[model samples]
Target chain A: MTEKTLIDARGSFCPGPLMELIAQLKSAEVGDEFEVLSSDKGSANDIPEWVEKAGHELVESREDKGVWHITVKKKR
Target chain B: MRILIIGGGMGGTILANNLARRLSSEIKAGKVNLTMLSASEKHFYQPGLLYLAVGQMMPDELYREQVSLLEPGIAFHVDPVTEFHLDENQVKTQSDRTYDYDVLVIATGSRVNMEEIPGLAENAEMFYTEEGALKMLKSLREFEGGRVVVCVGVPHKCPMAPLEITFMMHDFFKERGILDKVELYYTYPIGRIHSLENVAKWATPEFDQLGIKYETFFNMKEVDGDNKILRSEEGAEVNYDLLVTIPAHKGMEVVESQGLGKDGWVPIDRLRLNMEGRDNVFAIGDTTNLPISKAGSTAHFEAEALGENIASMVKIGQPVRDYDGKVFCFIEAGKDRATYASFDYLNPPDPKPPTRAVHWFKVAYNQLYWASARGLL
Candidate 1:
């Protein structure tokens, strides 16, 4: 079964959003979908880069009212 | 006999590794055992984090696996200490496991107390932890144009960090093309910009050039988040759009509970680092109320003295070695330049001096210290 988790990093800055995502990814099962909510503009672009470089799958990404919603799936 | 060391920070880890290398012969002779207990499994290159905050380095570059840094025959315990039974000469972990030792070294570092001031932890941010630094970096990047206040609370670790943040913020604003719109202000409890006169000599010129306003002898009293104002104990109020504060520091709760720290920190003899009026107990790093700046370099120097003293105690059964209370601080001046100062209370012949060469020396010194501690060189 697949599960989904959301990390609200809206008020956090660059690596904060990415670090939150990583902490969530640690507890997440492979193929589990995790979404990160970040108000940092860099996170919208940087998270995808990290996910790809780390061999994780970026499920989806979007922006709403200055908050970026980025979803990723743990690959391993 | 086993030697137990608590707190695997700069002091504990360096001492453990140095002892392991220097005392291998004794260990082979079935004389001594060494163990280090720590809560975290990562050895942070904390000095580099200052660079990381300004996007100069990545997180991975500032930390390494703790297990990888330990030499053979040294035992590592990844656990938080629950209590210290000084009478029993043992420590109990959170899991109810107890370890007895012939000697105990307390190196548990200081803790940031954000709750000391109202709305500080609620609204203002810090730069001590990795999370805090990352959050601060994010905020600095998103900072477009506004009055940013860098406040230094009373008695904090790395006393120069707030000043460093101000210099970096000045550089950040200049690079973003908003130097004019952004007003930089610093409020500190100290009488001068830096405790050391040598560092103030180098830093004051940079502050003047950058137009960063600072108030010395202004003790931060409270944070009025609703009004965007920080009030000092002297009744002076400074208004700001964004506030970044270095909060007050305190000894670990465990230390306080065990009656180890009085006067806000563990009181140890400056010479031997042994707890006053206690046998077989020693302390190092920020945990001790040493009359010096609580910096990592101080901890590293103390650890060397401690390791040698511990070896002498175990091998020759001699009295502890004397610490000269020596310290050097690397002040990061903007424009990719830094200045260093050397101070030792006992060095009357060559009192504390500052040299331009010390600036470049600090860079090379860090690499040498790290490599030597990790046994890589």
Candidate 2:
């Protein structure tokens, strides 16, 4: 069984949410999944871009109630 | 392990607090010690000065007690550092105390030298400090109309402040019904309006639309207050009734006094952030000679990077990550609109058109910055 880590990165500005996601992904196991909730529109777009460039798997991306939900699975 | 962080400003404070959290167990077990020394008991939010100058915020909102922001398990002090004994891995403070550390982080920050230009300090309006911002507000209130020249110095903190202030001033005068009476002119030391290429491209059209005249390649040579004349190194002179300036900056006094780097900017490895030759000695924020924006986000990101690395070094004997030269800045485009530029070492930022939503976000960020300083946000 794999656990999904949820990070509440709302109210933080650009690069804050992305950084938190990266910090978690750095220590996460290869198959572990982590989701980040960010109110910053810039970081919502940035997290997936970073995930793609970093060779991670973007499992899901959605928006609800002005909050962005981005989930990525560790591939490395 | 003794971690001595000198200068309890944004970089040092964030790094210390972050380390305190990551190494909490080690701290409790007496395996690690975290100490910080700063010059002041108050931690100032520098970005507030811009809003203060524009009357969007007040002075009392910009300060918080430095020790109040720190987490427990980190030893904090207000004694300023006087000397750097890097060879002995120790530092001497003004109160005649010596601190030794296995790892040293130098976040001493930078300072503006307005005196470098003759008549500048005495005559021009500057908003880099609390007093400067208050004085500028008074000057703005007293002035009805004239040629207001906004000249910028190189390597200053907050790369967006020059343009932000210019745009905000336009709105300020407009709201005061003196928009047509004031002739706002801007000057930059570089060929472009901003050091960043993309920002210059974006701001040029905005300046043209706003009726803000500008001259590039204008390095401030001196200010003639008596004659109201401003001279640049390129020899083109600008005549103005009111002079607003951003003075050139240099690293902290101790950094220069100890022969750290040219003009007090200690050279560091871009990724590792270690002072040129020493692995244990690290430099960040405005003090490092990195060709990047000297903004708060730069320091924040660098501190987090250093914190993680230091913690990993204490636990795993090596760093797991590197700083990618990240910087994020919100550009206030006046009239209650703003946009942001976000980029890193390998990527350049593409700032979109200003939006009301982005502007409100910036306004909210002014309040949220407190949480950020506490390493909470």
Model number with the top TM-score? 2
- Compute the lDDT of residue B326 as modeled in candidate 2: 83
Could you tally the backbone clashes for each prediction? 0, 0
Which lDDT tens digits does candidate 1 get at residues B220-316?
6788999998887546789988788877677788898877874247888878889988869989888986655677877888888988988888778
Q: Please identify model 1 stretches exceeding 4 Å from their true place.
A: A1-76, B347-369, B375-377
RMSD of each: 18.7, 14.2
Residue A52, candidate 1: Cα error in Å is 60
lDDT (CA) for every model shown?
0.74, 0.85
lDDT of 1 at B371: 76
**Highest lDDT, which number?**
2
Clashing pairs in 1: none
Q: Specify the poorest-scoring 10-residue window by lDDT in model 2 chain B.
A: B189-198
